[model samples]
Target: MAAQQSQGIQTLLEAEKEAAKIVQQARQYRVQKLKDARSEASKEIEEYKKAKEQEFKAFEASHAGTTSTTQAALDKETDAKLKEIEALFQSKKKDVVNTLLQRATQVQPELNRNLKKLQA
Candidate 1:
């Protein structure tokens, strides 16, 4: 009976050691799996970020082209309007100067005649 008890104790110790070894192996596997998952997620995030950056850059480039074309058209219209105004000013300037000169010459002769009569 004593020998039987000693054999039972040895069997129980072996079983406990095997259970501890299995638990340790499971913990190591879980840690390695978590590390792998984190690595995959980080890679995917970086790829998504790069794709978004490229998309935004393309959008900005298109917007800039549209803006430049619109600005050029607006500038052309402004230049045409300025030219028309300049032409109108040039065309009217000669007539205005000639009329003023004629009026001044006619009025001066009458004023001198009146002054001579008053002196006499």
Candidate 2:
């Protein structure tokens, strides 16, 4: 019937409008959250970096040799520790990546389940 077809179109149009509104609102919320997260992350990073630099400068100043002997001793120890940390990081980085990949593989089934539920 002509009337039925018109009514179906009207219903479909209204459903589309509602879906559009929901999608627009969700997009706006996501944009706001992303901006807020970025701002917070930048602020925290700036504070941390500033604090670390200040700490290092203070330490260097306090240790500011009345003598070259103390300065050389500090420099040597710092260099050795830094090299040790770098080697440790190089060895562990591959293990960290492998662990992440293994975890992702384990979660594949759960991800599929969630996708199925969302589609249903």
Candidate 3:
């Protein structure tokens, strides 16, 4: 009977060891699955970023010609305005100079009131 009891105890210990090994394997599998999920998520985010960049580049390329043409039109308008102003200045310049010259050459002379008191 004592020998049979010793064998039963040994079997229980072996079963406990097997359970421990299975638990360890389960934990390792869970850790490996978590790592794989993170790697997949990173790959998805990188792909999304690249796709957005390409979309932005396409939009910029589509608008590039319009931007340059609009800039050229604005430059032409500005140049026309400058030419009109220069022509107006040239047409008025001689008249303005002649008026200034006439005002400078025409002078009125007045006698000092103190001269009478000095004579007295």
Candidates 2 and 3 compared by lDDT, better number: 3
For 22-58, candidate 2 gives per-residue lDDT tens digits of 9999999999999999999999999999999999999
Candidate numbers, best TM-score first, in rank order? 3, 1, 2
Q: What's the C-alpha lDDT at position 89 in model 2? A: 99
TM-scores, one per candidate: 0.58, 0.51, 0.64
**Cα lDDT of model 1 by residue, 35-117, tens digit:** 99999999999999999999999999989989999999999999999999999999999999999999987774345777889
Per model, how many backbone clashes are there? 0, 0, 0
Among residues 3 or more apart in sequence or in different chains, the pairs in candidate 1 whose N, CA or C atoms overlap within 3 Å are none
Best by lDDT: 3
Which segments of candidate 1 are over 4 A away from where they belong? 71-120
TM-score of 3: 0.64
Write down the RMSD of all candidates, one decimal each: 10.8, 33.5, 5.9
Return the lDDT, model 1, position 98: 97
